[model samples]
Target: MNITKDLVPSIAYQVRTQEGVLVDEAPVNQPLEYLHGHNNLVEGLEKALEGKAVGDVFEVRVKPEEGYGEYNDNMVQRVPKDVFMGVDELEVVCVLLRTRI
Candidate 1:
């Protein structure tokens, strides 16, 4: 079925920076699923995926504004490596989730 609003679509994707740095990816055997038209994905990606069908393969370039908003220098903060000492692993783009009970 064609992808459309309110439908759940499963996709294997790779995200890269304009400089060709690999940022993120999902393997075909384990695709990412999201609810369409519900702001579940970046704006440009959602637009590009609209109307696509299963097994379709394509590359989309999403600009800063469309993807994660423009980078701001003021938001940058220098943190000492020692701050993360004792952590089992530290990697770029690692997400830490905190749940409130």
Candidate 2:
């Protein structure tokens, strides 16, 4: 399928980077879907993908400030482990992050 310009709202394959590390591959099906020119992606990545299309494989570098806001030390907080006393398994990254939902 040939995707023309402005044919966004189409999901584009996304790959993430940090300090030269390729952390994850954009999932094929659930890849980053969004309306083009609608600020659905980081400004830098969007700018890089400006003329791209589906089935297009490429890399774009996003600065921390544009991507995740440079990792604040304040985001790290110590909570009592007792918070998980009832849960048989407590996952650090995913489970602990469940609070957002």
Candidate 3:
């Protein structure tokens, strides 16, 4: 059956970087299942899966804009380390902590 709006799809996918490095994947034994065409998947991936049937295997290249939107240099800013006072064991690269200024 072809994937369409409101239809749930079970798929096994391997996400790779442009350099062909493995990034993430849904195990074959545990395919990812989600409601199609409901913003449950990335816009590019959803578009690629459209009209695809079960057992259909294909490669999809999702541009940054279509997946997570283009990275903006202006969005990044330098903050003083003192801002994180009283917090121990801070990692070099940590999860983003967003707040409105």
Best by TM-score: 1
Model 3's number of clashes is: 0
lDDT for each of the candidates?
0.72, 0.50, 0.69
- For residues 1-101, write the lDDT of model 3, one tens digit per residue: 78889998888877655556565677678878989889887787788888889777777777666677676878878788889899875643311111110
Candidate No. with top lDDT = 1
Off by over 4 Å in 1: 77-101
**Steric overlap count per candidate:** 0, 0, 0
Q: lDDT by residue for model 2 over 16-77, one digit each (tens)?
A: 33333334444555655566566666766666667664556655556666555666779989
RMSD of each: 7.3, 7.5, 8.6
Whole-model lDDT for model 1 versus the true structure? 0.72
lDDT of 3: 0.69
Q: After superposition, how far is residue 21 of candidate 2 from its true place, in Å?
A: 8.0
Q: Put down candidate 1 lDDT per residue, 18-97, tens digits, no spaces.
A: 55666677777787888999999878788888888887777776766777767787887989888988887766662111
Q: Which pairs clash inside model 2?
A: none
Residue 57, model 1, lDDT:
74
User: Against the true structure, what is each candidate's TM-score?
Assistant: 0.75, 0.52, 0.70
Please give the TM-score that candidate 3 achieves against the real structure.
0.70
